[model samples]
Target: MDVVFSDVKGMKEEQEQQISLVAERNNVSKENKFHKDEQRKERMLELFLRTKESILEGWRQW
Candidate 1:
């Protein structure tokens, strides 16, 4: 669980950096690219959270 938590944290940080770079390149703060990137990141975070919950549930069942 610790390993997965670390991996998700790293991924979130990396994605944030990438989103900033994309926004810089596009020369827009509130553009479609930024919105889409944010949405994607949110989805990714959601998935990771769901996975963590599932893992915990499995452990509880065991």
Candidate 2:
């Protein structure tokens, strides 16, 4: 009976550790995804501003 209890306790600890690891991994994945989205938005905005500036400069020359 004691051996069975010990085995159960070990299994519970292992499962808890696995759960914590998965949660951490998920958090990191979310952060990475958010970072990538922000970078993409910044790049798109930069492109738009550059295009707008070029068009305005052309009009000014005319």
Candidate 3:
């Protein structure tokens, strides 16, 4: 009976550890996705500004 109890306790601990690892991985993935999105937004803004400047310069030439 004691051996069976010990086995059950060990299994429970292992399951908890797996759950913790999965949660950590999910958090990291969310952070990475947010960072990528921020980078994409920054690039798009830069492109927009450059295009606007080009249009203004062309008007000046005219």
Candidate 4:
């Protein structure tokens, strides 16, 4: 009986550790995704500004 109880305790601890690891991984993934999205937005904004400037310069020359 004691051996069985010890086995159960070990299994429970291992499961908890696995759950914690998964949670940490998920958080890291979310942060990475967010960072990528932010970078994409910044690039888009830069492109928009460059295009706008080009258009304005052409109009000024005309």
Candidate 5:
């Protein structure tokens, strides 16, 4: 009986640790995805601004 109880206790602790690790990994993945989305948006905006500037420069010569 004592050995059974000890085994149960150990299993509970291991499960808790695993849950914590999984939660941490999920948070990091979310952060990385968000960071990538922001970078893409910034790049798209920069490209749009550059295109506009080029068009305006051409207009100026007319």
Candidate 6:
């Protein structure tokens, strides 16, 4: 649980940084790059969260 918690925290921090970078770049003339990157990151985060939930649920079942 602790490990999962720490991982989620780290991932959240990284996601924040990624989003912030995109936000900063938004002022400049960039096409779908930022949007694509954000979508990619979001999808990755969602997968990670789902995997984490599944693992936790499995642990609980044990």
Query: Best candidate per TM-score, number?
Result: 4
Candidate 5: which pairs clash?
A: none
- After TM-score superposition, the amount by which residue 18's alpha carbon in candidate 5 deviates from its true location, in angstroms, is 0.8
Q: How many backbone clashes does candidate 3 have?
A: 0
**What TM-score quantifies how close candidate 6 is to the native fold?**
0.51
Against the true structure, candidate 1 reaches a TM-score of 0.52
Worst 10 residues of 5 by lDDT: 53-62
Q: Summarize candidate 4's per-residue lDDT along 5-45 as a digit string, tens digits.
A: 99999999999999999999999999999999999999999
Alpha-carbon local distance difference test for all models: 0.94, 1.00, 1.00, 1.00, 0.99, 0.91
Model 5: how far residue 11 lies from native, Å: 0.7
**How many clashing residue pairs appear in each of the predictions shown?**
0, 0, 0, 0, 0, 0
Q: Once superposed on the true structure, which residue ranges of model 4 sit more than 4 Å away at CA?
A: none
Off by over 4 Å in 6: 1-29
* Cα deviation of 13, candidate 2, in Å: 0.5
- Put down candidate 1 lDDT per residue, 25-62, tens digits, no spaces: 77765587789999999999999999999999999999
> What tens digits encode model 5's per-residue C-alpha lDDT throughout 1-51?
999999999999999999999999999999999999999999999999999
Candidate 2 residue pairs in backbone clash? none
lDDT of 6 at 57: 100
List RMSD in Å for every model shown: 23.6, 0.8, 0.7, 0.6, 1.0, 24.6
| Ten residues in sequence with the least summed lDDT for candidate 2 | 1-10
RMSD of 5: 1.0
TM-score of 5: 0.89
Q: Candidate 6, clashing residue pairs?
A: none
Cα lDDT for residue 4, candidate 4? 100
